[model samples]
Target: MNAATMRAVQVVRAGAPFAVTQLPVPEPGPGAVRIKVHACGVCGGENLARLGLLGVQLPRVPGHEIAGTVDAAGPGVTVWKPGDRVGVGWHGGSCFVCDSCRTGDFVNCADRRIVGLHYDGGYAEYVVAPQDALARIPAALSFEEAGPLMCAGITTFNALRNCGARPGDTVAVQGVGGLGHLAVQFADRMGFRTVAVNRGRDKEAIARQLGADEYIDSTEDKSPGEVLGRLGGAAAVISTVGSSPAQADIVQGLSPNGRLVVIATDHEPIPLGPELLVFGRRVVAGWYSGHAKDSEEAMAFAALKGVRPMVETRPLEDAEAAFQNLGAARFRTVLTL
Candidate 1:
């Protein structure tokens, strides 16, 4: 391959397999910077685009959690320079003129774009990212560790920190995979009485090791709500799994005026009974991955607290395998270049 071209994995058509092929290493456009990718983390949301569910344009590269070094910068891109360690997450860019952006809530901007879905992303050796989407990676964090933090890490960390669960309240993290594991750590570290709710006894040991003070084995207990109710209910439940039933089961376990903070991108609607909301004044809300500044803060917090994600890595050429193994990754997956 010449200097102008680089290897990439592309989904040539919806519902089709990812193909390893050559594409021109993109040059940075206006207000953009070109990155020499060191690592790109796989995300569950890619399944939507891979199956044509996200209405993504064909022949796109699919990845959002990216960590790399800036190799070039375009005009008007003063915040980033060549050789800077950086990362980009799901919130690719937004129209700064929108009311949401004007209010400092770019995630809600009508013109907000998502990495991998709205445009090409970090599934290649080089990706051109908007300057506003970039976050500086700290020198203490490795590219592999920082890659997943760009999306999964920031989402879980930001959601729990802002979810209204007090430091001493009983906070339950429903699910012990991917996002839930991190949620448990954050809840415990943040001084909440952390509980891990998972299906089997297999995760109990790890949950305790991760600082969860209690474990709810849903498979053996059958009803998570009943189990949680017996423990005096949770002040907040961070629902991280995609299963609607799992989300529904936890509602009865919420303390009066408690919240169910939904973060998983599940397509199925969570069935909610009106009584659950009316009787207790309970609330359900969703939180998206934050902007670059939030991502930076999440990284710094993780670094300070020694919070790390369990990741399985594959070479860039094995991107297809990395994508396929996302479920079995135990927590998260990263492709290294």
Candidate 2:
């Protein structure tokens, strides 16, 4: 196939605002595959990338939630073929020889590159993905419906699945935006007593529709501890947001021995009372997206459980506007190529 330049959203300088323009479509390099993007989901991390937080490699593309067909494959790329449908998430690639990779845990690979930052990402029509990080897009789902899962879906899915969330356990999803919404659905299918914890009762109906068995509006009841007291405490509380205020709100809400898992946010200087950790308890942290295989398993499970993201799709050229809108909107946005 003849290669041609394509339109892309590029942040050409660090600490400066982003802009959109055309750039030549990239060719697959060694151990890589060039994906003809179908849809690219805007992520919160991408905003961080935009602000030069991920080491500020400009001109940056700043998108990782990718889904598309493989248009070309590079030497040593054995896993994919031209025209095959695939998806890429936050994890772009990993050093295969690293200890983590040797243990089949690519997510922990020390030299891993994030999709939009470490490597050129999916905000354009073509994105170069590492052979080891690509996951097959399930036939049951469409490009738009499947976009956010590449990141939001797999990350939240891996969190609970990896933590051994079992049936009938009480799982509380704190914040019902991008990640929290899907977490509720996953918890529900796992047979957990799902609880959605958010700021207002406004999201109650929405949370319930996503399979939350109960809702706790933190604004009305600032004490998540008292609110969760009604459900007898949660087996685990997944704080989807990392802002200091949000972290401070839910860290103490976990049950005795129950864990608090934080993902994709800056939940640092985690202010916790010393008394909260007196027992044989813990607060764990992890990335939401998993290995390529883990992503595939997450997709299959979502398919089986009827868990899907509620997304809005816009044309690829509108990526910049879409991203800005994403920062303000209630639901996640997917850019259709």
Against the reference, the lDDT scores of all candidates come to 0.88, 0.81
Name the 10 consecutive residues with the lowest summed lDDT in model 2.
279-288
Cα lDDT tens digits, model 2, 1-337, are 4667887888777655557788898988899999999899888787666777757578888788899999999999987999898988888888989998899877888999888888788889898888988999889988887788888898888888766556888888888998888988998998899999888788899899989999988888668756785668777877787665666556566677777777746745776666766764745555557777877888889988899998988887787677778656667899888
Off by over 4 Å in 2: 280-284
Best by lDDT: 1
**TM-score of candidate 1 to 2 decimals:** 0.97
Tens-digit lDDT track of model 1 for 185-277? 878888999989998999899999999999999998778977997898999999888888889889999999999999984679888788999
Candidate 2 clashing pairs? 155-288, 155-289
Query: Candidate 2, overall lDDT?
Result: 0.81
Model 2 RMSD, rounded to 1 decimal: 1.8
Best by TM-score: 1
